[model samples]
Target chain A: MVKVTCPICGGKLDIPEDSLPGELFEHEDCGAHLELVINEGRFELKLAEEIAEDWGQ
Target chain B: MRIGLAYDLIRWEEKALAYTIKDLGHTLELIHVPESVFYLTEPTIRGLDVTFERCVSFYRALASSLTLEAQGVFVVNTFDVIRNCGDKMLTTAVLAKKGVPVPRTMIAFDKVRALEAAKTIGYPVVVKPIYGSWGRMIAKADDESSLLDILDFRENMPSPHFQIHYIQEFIRKPGRDIRAYYLWGEVPVAIYRVSRNWKTNTALGARAEPANLDESTKELVIKAGEAMGSGVLGVDLMEDEDGRIVVSEVNAVVEFKNTVRVTGYDLPRKIVSSTVEALKA
Candidate 1:
């Protein structure tokens, strides 16, 4: 399992080993939605942005 | 509980679904559609009770839904529903057969017959691709000259589908159209996409205003959804000069950002709740 920290609340997350980058996860303790990412092989989490239908016509 | 999201690109709607799943005490998996390979047999995508189909491309959405369903994964806006709502020709046929009021439409495969069909429908008819959305490639032939010019462009197009002339009578509405987000055939919210232009798609910068449908209109919307199989969808309708509301189109993969904004309703919550309920059944 990949261990990461939620940027929104500093809560630790045990991300799945199979989880890919750009995968979204929610913090159990802080209840914050975050994206599981990697920078230089280091796990990173960023608060997810709100969904928008920018492509809607 | 776990929910899988089959998506091509990340959009606000996807994020909302993920957030809602999490808030509801479930895990959300973002299974990127372009990267996930569909297996003809056995299992490929696993670890989910159900999946929310959110691919922007109609072809991808339909194919992915079929593959997921094959693996016993419940997909919102199921494969059959996607196909029925995504194709204009099939959708119109269903609506007409169901006695759901829709614009008078005719299709022809050749340029000569296309002109003839347009004349029969009278001038100022709409020429649209059999498969498309967002008001793209839709032309209004106001007269014989405009119809010929539009057909000239369509005839020379390389895509064979474009060569097929899908003609429909353009209902003269009062500078706006109705767009309602139906969660399993229930219209929780509706909005008016007001545009001075003939095309009132919100993608073209149409202003949104909260609206409500009358009793009859609600029945028509439900019938349209039933014709395509039930799931979360966007149903489009228009009011003619005589105040008759007619079903224009049904979007299987609908965008509800504007509806949420103007109506002040928690659409994501409602959608997630509906999804959870469907999964249980």
Candidate 2:
């Protein structure tokens, strides 16, 4: 498991090692949606942008 | 009532929709379209009163909705409605055919013709792809020189769509544009996306505020929605320099995340209810 910290609320969370780079999951303590990205085998979390219904143009 | 949600990702709209579906005392079926496959014979997916086409991909959304409807499922935005509104050209044609006002537009196939069409429409015209969202690939050609440059860039582009030119008169308006949510021709919520940029898409950092829609604007929005036979749609309107409301675009699979935020209206509840109302008949 990868230990991740929420950037918004500073909450600690664990992400599975096998999770894909673009996998989106919610923070346990704050419920903020975060995307897991792997950079050179290191885990980085990014706050996922909310998509509007007709997002792409 | 049993409802099926066909989607690619669970955005805030979907989450709220699920909650509203449950709260409305209906069974929710999350049918992730990306993982699901269609069969020619006896697909076996049943018990759905109405399946909402919430997929992000326009092609996939239309195809899946049509496939599911073929297999005895009713999609919220029917194939006919989605098809009409999905294409920018078709939307404009329908609106114009229905006597609803739209910006003057011209379509051309090559650079020379595109330039000719631009000259006819005058300079600083808005150029956009036939099928797109978020104001991406939408630009303005200030003059013959810049228009040629813009067309030249698209000339070398790989996509065949770029080969076709969609040029329209740029409506100089107040620094804001209106995006209204319509369910079966009813305006549930409307918001003004305020931005200094000419392209005022909420996704492009436009500040969303509640819109004060006039009676005529609301009526025109309904007409625009009905023209495309859309049960759920996003009607984008902008006032010209003369304050005339010109229908800009109509989105079939409408998104209301920003609309909900600005108005605090029960976006999903209205969607679910409007869908139910549409199915009634």
Top-scoring candidate (TM-score): 2
Q: Interface RMSD, all models, one decimal each?
A: 6.0, 6.0
Model 1 CA deviation exceeding 4 Å by range? A1-57
In candidate 2, position B49 carries an lDDT of 94
For residue B128, model 1's alpha carbon misses the true position, in angstroms, by: 0.5
Candidate DockQ values, in order, are 0.09, 0.17
Backbone-clash count (model 2)? 5
Kindly give the stretch of ten consecutive residues in candidate 2 chain B with the minimal lDDT sum: B32-41
DockQ of 2: 0.17
The per-model lDDT (C-alpha) reads: 0.83, 0.83
Per residue, candidate 2 scores C-alpha lDDT tens digits across B1-281 of: 89988876666777778779989999988776756797647767878899888877777788888898888998878888887777888888889999999999999999889888988999889998887788888899899898888888888988787888999999997999999887876897899999999999987899999987888899999989888886888899998889889999988777888888878898889999878877885
Candidate 2 positional error at B176, Å:
0.7
